[model samples]
Target: MDVTPVMSSASTPATGTTGSLAAMAQQAWGALSYAARTVGVPAGVRGLAVEVAYTAVHLSVYPWGLLDEALRPGGVHAHHRTDSLPPYERSRLVSDLDGSSTPVLLVHGIVDNRSIFHYLARTLRRRGHGTVQAVNYSPLTAFTGDIRTAARDLGDHVERLCAVSGVDRVHIVGHSLGGLISRYYVQRLGGDARVDTLVTLGTPHRGSAIAHLLPPTLVPRQLQPGSDLLRELEEPAPDCRTRFLAVWSRMDQLIIPQRNARLEHPDLDVENVRLEHVGHMAMTIDPEVVHLVACRLGRTRSPRDRIAPVAAAG
Candidate 1:
């Protein structure tokens, strides 16, 4: 089977390898328990249990679900094939972009691939941006683990794209965890030089209370604030060419305290839109959020561009 992701304007990239064997085991246990409860004991249950147990045993070998890519000749996982695209797809993308440097990269959130950006990318393309590339990465792995790797990978991709497309820099639009991942890339991995704009929709910048409410075994502790992942996100870095914008909603269920959506960087440009009655995931593909991102992307100014008016008025 082709394990590579389809090269959609909205497909996730390949996943990085995982490190936590214990966490994988715990996730397996929970899945098994849920399956047993759903089916109950009987001949049916026994048959299902056998399948479930078989799956559990294999989960250790394939945490990210690649049959052989995650093991053997691995430190970084091997690249696999996607049913959607041939290896030469990158060449075709260059041709599609027509050698013009469109200044946008869309990265999706946890458990989501580029598909989350399908509607938004199509709309933006209609608006006449030069080119758009989606960062596709698996989410089952730890945020700090695979995500960090993803950020680095993105940096490499950006370099290659710039070289091929003759674009000096690209704007970045991220939704939910994608936003966080984008921030990490720009701020920590020195992606600021290659990116011009950073727009985050429904990102949880300060960590989520909903994450805290979940059982520790069910979700990694690193998801909480003060954890390694959050701490890395909070670390200070030198300024770059990238401008920042964040679109927040009042009713984001996933981002508890809602204020978690706020960007802490005083140096980066920040904007907040009050999205009423919109949930976290909904904002990813919301038309209003997409408009806000496009508008922000079109602006060329310092991060402090609009701060004086609010401060003087306050």
Candidate 2:
């Protein structure tokens, strides 16, 4: 399949900042009050039930934390002990290259494991960007802690993989909460040194409506709006060495108010692109998202090359 990498226009107009704080605060308060009022009344019982059921099935079948010590492109589900899949080794773009192909690290969001990017990994590998790695985490833990720990683990995994592959640094692509984690790694944990590029798909950088809707006890208070993590991302930081591409979907059902899905930063190099049809989950499976990732991986063959999703249609 032919792939043309999509690049947002260079003219990245500054997103409006007027009343953003008040609006966000209002949303946060409303969500908090709603959760408070409906503490045990089953706030969105259907969504909660579906979320619980999906996780139960995944944990029962694919528990990987017990056996796997490393993360790879097509590694077994972190929840279930299984074999790690090799890096995507058949990129149409890098098939002819020697031993310097750039690696891509894939991470999933809350309540999810590495399987989220299975389709994307397979497609990118077929296109010749075979050095893909996926990170898995336990969903029951606090989301903030999970992101911090995952980044540290992922950095180590990248270093070890690079030693074996002879590639210095790799690209990072995160979905939903994963994206926020990647940002934390870069902003606070100094992950920019190890990553060449960062691509975030449907990440709720500013916080989410669903999080707001969840009862306070079920959701960690630290991850809520105005939390320490979001505060860090809000502050201006030096331009990271890693190029960033943020892909968002207008139809996101989980990220309430959808617009909060995109991160607005003043001192950063980024491309904010919006995809209309895909929802939060569809980002991992959609072909358009796959193609975009392939193009990024192909162009970023070496650490020197820097470059950087979608709706839910399953």
Clashes of 1: 10
lDDT per residue (tens digit) for residues 11-99 in model 1: 23323224366578887897576445444546434444544554354334333333222343221112212233343544433444422
lDDT of 2 by residue, 1-314 (tens): 54333344444323334467668999899867654443334534433454456446546645553234344333522212112333443334345463225677787887777766766876765565546667776666443355567667767776776776676677889988878778778777777776777889998877775676554643354356666668867886764666678888765667766677777887676878786656567677667777886676555534334322001211
Q: How far does residue 67 in candidate 1 sit from its true spot (Å)?
A: 17
Q: What TM-score does prediction 2 earn?
A: 0.66
What's the true lDDT of residue 308 in model 2? 21
CA deviation > 4 Å runs, candidate 2? 1-100, 143-146, 215-219, 301-314
- Scored by CA lDDT, what does every candidate get? 0.63, 0.65
Candidate 1 has a TM-score of 0.60
What's the count of clashing pairs in each model shown? 10, 23
